[model samples]
Target: MKRRHFIAAAIAAASLSGAYPALAETDQVRVGYIADFWGASATAVATEQGLWEKHGLDADTKVFTNGPLQIQALGTNSLDFGYIGPGALWLPASDKARVVAISSVGNSDRILAREGVTSLADLKGKKVAVPEGTSGDMLLGLALEAAGMSRDDLEIVTADPATVVSAFASGQVDGAAIWYPFVDVIRKANPGIVELAKNADFPQNQFPAAFVTNPATVTDRPELVGKFIAVMKEAGDWRHANPAETIKITADFLGVDAAVLEQEATMGTSFTAEDLAAKSKDGTINSWLDGMAAIYVKQGKLEKALPAADYYTADLFVK
Candidate 1:
């Protein structure tokens, strides 16, 4: 069956049985998201634009400090859906949770450092703040490796992305592995800080951001998942059309200045279902998963290697 048709039929069947009611019938469909850059803004736009409600889902968004906690909520089924980095999905998928890539949020990573530090080698003995076990941390490790250094070469600290800005300014950490908007904020406060790396420098540009759900939910509530994807696509289309407006909404939602949000938005790449499907079929996303799996295995985080492609289902995105 065509993907869209199947989703529509599933939604119709569920609605008739009073299984998944409209948002008005319930408080909201809980969604967990990280508070970095476009993460929270995309969710806000989906809610503000009424996409979730239009698809028979409510907009109940919970802010998570990092991916591990977000994945934890999805595993417990506390959240109907959530966004996470590709690397974080492996651990949960091993535990039987089914995650799907609904769409791309954005790509805006940077390795920021204080003045006088022009390169990774200059980071020796310096404290760097990164959310441990996150894709950002993985990216940092890759950047370090490229510099012929390893995590053992520096002091890595784990902290919230928001706090990292203050941490950098207050000398809590010498450098931070963060994304845009926050990078903008950090630079503004410490004008001499330098950004040493970004996604373009990474292999295969291997950052995959996704919206995922539990296997039980996908199996039992396929229609709901499809509708959710449609809603996300709607938000993505809106974001593409109104870049300025989207930035304003995101900045207001995040309580950051509009200019910082604008800078971050400009650097972000928004993808629709079709774009994601193309990447999936072409092994673009598979390569990223494979790379992450290899990293985790080498770090002793995973005992067995995973078939990277098996961690995601692209059928949901194909119509």
Candidate 2:
């Protein structure tokens, strides 16, 4: 099945059932993540392989269209644990949510331009599609600024992640700033697409997708949070050990092409126990969260930049 078909069926099922069927033997935890984002595959992997069951959790998963929506649900206690892109870091910095784990870090966000657009400056006055409050949106701003241009220089058409790919492919927009596997899809379909910039282009910025929960969840259910983190690590390590099988599993679960997933399979950070211990002990992951918070501060979305320790805790992972 294609991703769109799967999304439609999932939505219909969710509407009719109101929730995933829960097992009576395990504790229920509501999990959320941006749809199609490979960084959030840990949850999907856990669910697919019954890692949640192994860890004594019956996780009910929800697919969000973007990071901010997931953050909103987290704020309302609708999502117990979920993934948030760098753009939504302000929510956690402002106490709307709390970061518990660093899922992946790399240059997954890209500004893809159609043929004849050789530079970021070429995008001026051209329609560019991108979803607001996403890592793609943040990367777009950085790319524009690097070219000494502003959003006013181009026509910014707000579109969802899935919509951007279709619009870009049909020539509805001249350019699109989006993340993989959409970027991969667009490039594969349209050979003329030029990568204007990616998160990696700005070496100063670290693009990390974080696993987060509301502050209340952290305070009230510490053990549950710990178990969730443990399962995430288990899933992550499994992906590291089984790259080809991981691609097949993710393709089956997400309904994306296995080929596309294979090309970007290494995008998700797979940390071993030693890697986690070393990074957590040295506060490397916390610094990445703080860096994202700083971007929110500069954008005026946050009143003040909080220390990563203020909005994030590695205690659950380190314990």
Q: What are the clashing pairs of model 1? A: none
Model 2 spans with C-alpha error above 4 angstroms: 1-25
* Candidate 1 segments whose C-alpha is farther than 4 A from its true place: 1-28, 86-96, 298-300
lDDT, candidate 1, residue 314? Answer: 66
TM-score of 1: 0.83
Question: Distance (Å) between predicted and true CA of 198, model 1?
Answer: 1.9
The Cα error of candidate 1 at residue 35, in Å, is: 2.6
Q: Tell me, by lDDT, which candidate is best.
A: 2
The true-versus-predicted C-alpha distance at residue 245 of model 2, in Å, is: 1.4
Report every candidate's CA lDDT.
0.68, 0.75
